[model samples]
Target: MTAILSVSDLTVAYGGVTAIDGVSLSVDDGEIVTVLGANGAGKTTLLLAIMGAVPASRGRIALRGTDVSRSRAHHRLAQGLVLVPEGRQVLVSLTVEENLLLGAHLRRDRQAVRNEIAAIYERFPNLGQRRHTAAATLSGGEQQMVAIGRAMVARPQVLMLDEPSLGLSPLFVSKVFDLIEEMNRSGLTIVLVEQNTGKALSVAHSATVLELGKVAIAGPSEALRNDHRLLEAYLGGAADIADEPSSMRANSQ
Candidate 1:
């Protein structure tokens, strides 16, 4: 199958510092591709650039076969490319249902949008139960659910997630990974940027390791999992990839 999303020689810079350099990767239709790296590894920069949040110094971004390298972020969203950013940037002041409705702000089909929101509530019962609750009052895990649900409300074909597992309890991490796999199984193409190497590799069909603005290692997740040296050098140590949580494995399978 042709790649649903493609990034070629992508580069992003801030004044004299280059965050991402010549990074290229592709996500196939219905595949989960994870990008792994330590802090400042250009992982987030790549995603931001792809989302058109950060201007690319060089490179091309394509959705399906269309070049959208210069498209605005909203334009990309209109093309079914959506990014659920890091930090669970939910509108804190708004109610959970209100925040979800904002995700469909670009849509004119009000009735269909309402139906999609209902569907999201069905998938995430917690959001449904707390629909009228202000997003700020929700716990971290609950807020993360709101973030994912908000992105789902946008109805993206290719979902790029930046650090979905960050700052969450172990239990919430497991829940997030399970939800990710569920979304993938339900036919969403995911490009994940995650710091939890073990969990990321566990659920990813393929993996890419970024170091100092370039791809240090890239291949099938199983192969990358066994490459202890690469993991040690770029991911702190080989032990980082050792703990493959049973929940993650189950979800991936």
Candidate 2:
């Protein structure tokens, strides 16, 4: 199958500093590809550039063979590329249901959008119970669920999530990771940007380790899991990878 998204020689700079440098990667249809790296390693920058929130200094970004290198952010969303940004930026003033509705603004099928909102509620019972509550009143994990629900409302073919597990308790992190896999199994391609390497590798179909804005390692997640040196460098150690027994399988997702 052809790649759903293709990025080549992508670079993003801030003033004179390069946040991302010559990054090249791709996410094939129906696969979860992860970009793993430490702080300031351009993981978020890569996502931003792909979503066209930040202009690339040099490179090509294509979706299903179409060149969208310089497409605007909304244009990318229309093309089935949606970004659930780092901070869960749900509309604080809006009710949970209203926030989900806003995400489907581009869709003309009103019934389908409504159905999707109901489906999201079913998937996240916590959201279902508090659908009428103001978003600001929800807890961190609840807000994260709303963010994911909002993105799903857009019905993106390829969802780029930045730091989905950030700031959540271990329990919430596990829950969120499972939801990500659930989303992927339900036919959404995902490009996960995560600081939590072990959890990311656990659910990713393939993984790429980025160092200082460039890809330091890119391979099947299993290979990376077994390679102590690479695993240690980007993911702490072999013990760390070993700790997540589920991540060592050929297909974690």
Candidate 3:
């Protein structure tokens, strides 16, 4: 499979501290690649670096084989590389629809944008029901859906999500994971940084566990999932129990 997104020996530093050190991973076209780690392990930093939100002190980043190491965040977004940041960074004062519209600001086809937003509403009926409601009034999970929708409007070929399930209720978390599986099934490539290690593993085709700013283990998701000791030793948080069997089946079949 051709890699849609690739990072080689990437490193990022904050002042004197190196956030991501010599990390490398690849997300194949239409495959879900997961990044898992404990706090301060630089999981979020890896996603930001890949999206060009943070400068890489060393190493290279490529999207669909095109080098984008020095590109700006907006430029990366225009290249179909998008990031749904860790905290649902929605414009609180804006209505749900308005916030989603912001994602297509760079798009020239107003009609296409409208169509895309409609598709987003179709996927998240709750958002459709509250399209006119202020984003601040929505629940945490709703805000997360809005954030993901906004990224979707940008027409991302590779979507990188940072700790998507953080601080959500179990009900919402399940919904979010289901949405992820549904999107991946439709041929969207995803690089997911998730705290729910078990869910992440089951959804991903491959996974890389970051440890203290470097890759501790990287392999097929099934291989890692079965190695419970390796996961428990390196995975930063408690793994959730839910496993979407269909997602795993997609890989084995």
Candidate 4:
């Protein structure tokens, strides 16, 4: 398993307030790695730092074994590091298709861009149905799909999503998670920053829990799912109820 993206001893601060503290993690090629934590637990910071959106105070960020800790965000993007930020940052004035096209502006292959758009439409039929409409007119879930679609248009090797399920109905959330799984299955490495522990853990191959900007526990998803102490700390009794099989049931002994 080769690491597509690697973060080592990463740290970031804002006006002297430390956000991420010596954090390290890796996303292997074609793996879905979820980072779960409560609000202000430094989940967003980690993603931003990894994407080079925020400056790292100390650490190294590597993409496919190439050091990119100081690379510009756009440079990092070109290297296949893409971030679909937490909010639906679609352009209100642009048509749905236009906003999506903007996502592929860096690509020199015009035909490929068109083909990718067609593929995106196929993957997200709703967006295809409203390709000409203003992005502002789409519903929250639809807007989120557009955001994710935009990132996909980049054909990223490593896709980092922050709070992707925020403000969606359960059905839409399921759809989003399913799409994520589908993306990973299609050979994209993923770093998912999510608050929805149950669904995230269910879909992730592995996970890391962030506590106060540091790793609390990290291992295979099934192991973390069945660790009673880790579950109780992050999920309360909900973990117990969420576990459907003995394999997923938290082990107290």
Candidate 5:
């Protein structure tokens, strides 16, 4: 099967420093591909580049056989690629329903937009119950739900989530992972950029470990779980990849 989304030899730099260096990865249709790394490892940069939120210094990005390397952010979204950024970046001043409405602003079909929002509400009944509430007043987990709901309204085929489980209570973290699994089971392809290593690997079909902007280790999730070097160097119990000695962070090539 062809990749629903793929990036090759992608490079991104911030003037004096490169955030990601010649990194490449792909997500097949309906598969969950997790990008794991510590802070400053360029995991988020990879997602931003793929979503067209940032420029790629060099590389090719393909979506379903079409090269989208030159596409703008909105155009990529139109191609069914959506990024729910980190930190649950909801418009805190807006009502829950209003925030969700913004996701469908690009769509012309009135009924379909309504139907999508309704489905989102059904999936997250808390949002349904408080649809009129201002986003600022919601709990962190609830706000995260709103963020995911907003993305769902866009009807993404390849939904890339940056830290869906970040900063939530234990209960919410579990719920967020469950939702990830549920969405994948419902036929949505996902590229998960997460710091919660163990949970991320548990639900992901495959995993890629990024260290200092390069892919350190990547393979099927099950196989990666048994990889002690990976677990010790990156997937240790921390919210981010564990800082290891120079030898530990060495390339797995």
Candidate 6:
């Protein structure tokens, strides 16, 4: 499969501290690739670097094989690269529909933009019901929906999500993952930065485990799911891998 987004030797630093250290990875066209790690492992930093929100101290980023290492955040967005940051970051003062409209602000086709808004409402009916409500008044799950919908309005070819499952109820987390799977099935490539290991691996085609700002293990989700030692070392403890599928048990042996 052709890579829709590629990062080679990407590194990000702040003052004397290097947050992302020579990391390299790729997201193939129409695949869901998850970046898994504990907090401060530089998962969020990698996503920000790819979106050009943070300057890379080294390496290259290519979108659909076109080099965009130095591109500005908006430029990357225009190139069909969009990031739904960790905090959901919806404009609290704006109504749900207004916030969604902002995602398509860079587009010149007003009518098409309007249609896209309607389509987003169709995909997320909860947002449609509260279209006129201020984003600040929405619940955490609702705000997350707004964030994802807002990014969708831009019609991105590659969408990068940072800690999308953060602070949501179990039901909402499942809903969010379901939406991601649905979107990927419709041919959208995704780079998912998440700490919710089980759900992340369940939906991901491949997994890359980041440790101390570098890749410690990278492979197909099925293989990684069965690697108990690697999971215990980087992902947490034995309980984390205890829920592995029965098929993974055979592979573990």
TM per candidate comes to: 0.93, 0.92, 0.93, 0.92, 0.92, 0.93
Clash pairs (backbone) in predicted model 5: none
lDDT tens string, model 2, 70-152? 78999999999999998789989999999999889899999999999999888889899999999999987899999999999
What does candidate 1's lDDT look like per residue over 98-195, in tens digits?
A: 99988898889989988988987887788889899999999878898889988988889999998887777778888899999999999999999887
Task: Give each model's whole-structure lDDT.
Answer: 0.86, 0.85, 0.86, 0.85, 0.85, 0.86
- Model 4 per-residue lDDT at 39: 63
Candidate 3 Cα errors over 4 Å, as ranges: 236-253
Please give the lDDT score at residue 166 for candidate 4. 74
- Steric clashes per prediction: 0, 0, 0, 0, 0, 0
Which stretches of model 1 miss by more than 4 angstroms?
241-253
- The alpha-carbon lDDT assigned to residue 55 of candidate 2 equals 89
Instruction: Give model 5's TM-score versus the native structure.
Output: 0.92
Candidate 6 yields a Cα-based lDDT of 0.86
List model 6 lDDT by residue over 78-108, tens digit each.
9999999987999999999999988988888
Give the C-alpha lDDT of model 4: 0.85
Give the per-residue lDDT of model 3 (tens digit) for 1-253.
9998889999999999999999999889999999988767898888888888788999999998999998998999999998999887999999999999999988999999999899989888999999999999999889999999999998999999887887777788888889999999999999998767778888999999889999998999999888877876886324433242322222110
Candidate 1 colliding pairs:
none
The residue pairs that clash in candidate 4, if any, are: none
Model 2 has an lDDT value of 0.85
How many pairs of residues collide in model 3?
0
